[model samples]
Target: MSLKYAVLAALLEGEASGYELSKVFDVSLANFWPATPQQLYRELERLAGDGLIEARTVPQERRPTKRMFSLTAAGREQLAAFAAEPTRRPTAVRDEFLIKMQAMDGVDPRAVRALVEERRAWALGKLARYERVRERLLDGRTEEEYLRDADRVGPYLTLLAGITFERDNARWCERVLTVLGERRAAAGPAGPAALG
Candidate 1:
């Protein structure tokens, strides 16, 4: 999907400044769809030019007036149309680390282990953050309430997706660690795992 669609999705939450959208992109959309603030700002301007989004200047007391953007009716229609179209299967590498691990018989196991450990730590930390955000959004409501009555569905659903993806990563890390340990023991004292 294009960045345009992602921008439209973000605007669906509510009107927001480019800065605010940038924050949303960083937290909510960074997992499946990553975009820099420069790209977001440029796309917002383009969407405005295309009459898909409306921008209004909100005056501030101290700082400069900020431009807030919201989707126009046309933008909403376009989004609906995009959603109605057939979903295209994205083609990309399924897992680079798995490939590296598979070749570890000849490759360096310690290097692969290092990479896995680093990624594990990152995924664990991000999962913790997502959990915190999910709790804050729910505010003690039950799961059924969170699923049925939440106002901000985009963040809500995306946050769940992020949580699931990170959880999967953590599992993969643990499996890899276990497999590495087995390989290390099987290799005895002079293994590639200990060489690095």
Candidate 2:
């Protein structure tokens, strides 16, 4: 998704300065969209120039003035149009490591396993973070609460997807480990897997 739409979606919650929008992007939109602070700031400028967002300088007592941003009518209209459009099919992962794994006969299996292990760990960490955020949001609420407040409901779905994805990655790692173990047991002398 475009940063423009992401910024507009974040501002839909409320008006925010660039710094606040950065935090909002991390906390709220991170599951579906991710952008660095630099990218957010640049997009804010573009949106303001396009008249899609209104910006006003907020004077501060002892600090530099911050430019606060909020969606204008055009911005809201854009978001509405975007929301109404049909979503395309999901894209596949474009990782170069997958290509390397497919041609792994020429490479070291251990190195590929290490890469997979690293990715699994990273995915697990993100899954843990999403779980924490979901717990915080859900609190002790029931399904009724979610049904009532539909605007704040994207996290749980994305969290579930991420958790399942990481869990599958962990399973994949276990299967790979088993295959590697068998290969190691059979090939004793050179241990070609150790090349990595």
Candidate 3:
């Protein structure tokens, strides 16, 4: 998906300055669509130029004017059309960590183990953050009530997917660590190379 659609979808929450939108992307959309602040700013400009979003200049007392953006009708229609399009491409996993794992047998297993542990820790951290986001979204309501009565469920549902992805990642990392530990024990003294 393009950053255009991501920015447009974000504006659905309400009008926001580019800075505010960047924060929203960092917190809420990072799981699915990661963008640097520069990238977001560039996309915002493009979207504005394309007439998909309208920018309002807000004067500040002590600072330079800031531009806040809101989705134009065209933006909404564009997002809707993008959403309606059937996803023809399969999801792809293009992680450098996976490449490192694949080459583990050719390198030091200890190093690879450390990297996997780091990934597991990151996944756990993200899972915790997503849980907090979920709680905030639910706002004291039960999941059923939130899902049934919330004006918008897209954010909540996407957050759920992020939570699940992180949870599964942590679990997979745990299994990998266990298997590596077992193999190390079976190989004895000289490390993984000894198994060969």
Candidate 4:
């Protein structure tokens, strides 16, 4: 999907400045549709130009004026039509880390293990961040309450997918580390060459 749709969907939350939208993308959409602040700002301008969104300049007492954006009726219609489209491309995995893992046999096992360990830590950190977001989204409500009564549940559902993905990633990394450790142990003091 284009960044246009992502911006439109984010505006569904309500009116926000470009800076605010960047933060929203970082906390929420970073998992699936990562965008730099510059990209978002440019998309916002394009969206406004296309009449898909409306922007109003808001004056501040002590700061420069900022433009707040909201989805126009046309933007909503566009988003709805895009959502109704029947076909979507399947997700493809294109990770550099996976490529390195594939070439692990030719590299130092110690180096590969360090990379895997780093990945696991990163995944765990993401999982923790996602959990915090989930809590904040839920507020004081239980999961059942939030899911049943919240006006928008798409964010919550997507957050769940992200949590699951990170959990699975961390688990897979642990398993890989275990297997590599075993192989290294078997290879003994002679090092990775002994494995051959």
Best by lDDT: 4
Assess each prediction's global lDDT (C-alpha) against the native: 0.85, 0.77, 0.89, 0.90
lDDT of 2 by residue, 15-129 (tens): 8999987886675466567778999999999999999999999999999899999999999999989878887647456657667667766667767778778877876777687
What lDDT does model 2 reach?
0.77
For each of the candidates, give the backbone clash count: 0, 0, 0, 0
Residue 183 lDDT, candidate 4, scale 0-100: 85
The alpha-carbon lDDT assigned to residue 77 of candidate 1 equals: 98
Worst 10 residues of 2 by lDDT: 88-97
Better model by lDDT, 1 or 4? 4
Residue 107 lDDT (model 3): 72
Encode model 3's per-residue lDDT on 88-186: one tens digit a residue: 667666789988888778777778789999999999998998899898889899999999999999999999988999999999999999998998889
Residue-by-residue lDDT tens digits, candidate 4, 45-100? 99999999999999999999999999999999999999788757776667899999
What are the clashing pairs of model 2?
none
Worst 10-residue stretch by lDDT in candidate 1? 187-196
lDDT per residue for candidate 1 within 70-174, as digits (tens), equals: 999999999989978887767343667777767766657777789889989988998998898889888999868888987756677878988998999999999
- Where does candidate 2 stray beyond 4 Å? 23-30, 59-64, 88-92, 143-151, 188-196
Q: What TM-score does each of the candidates earn? A: 0.85, 0.76, 0.91, 0.91
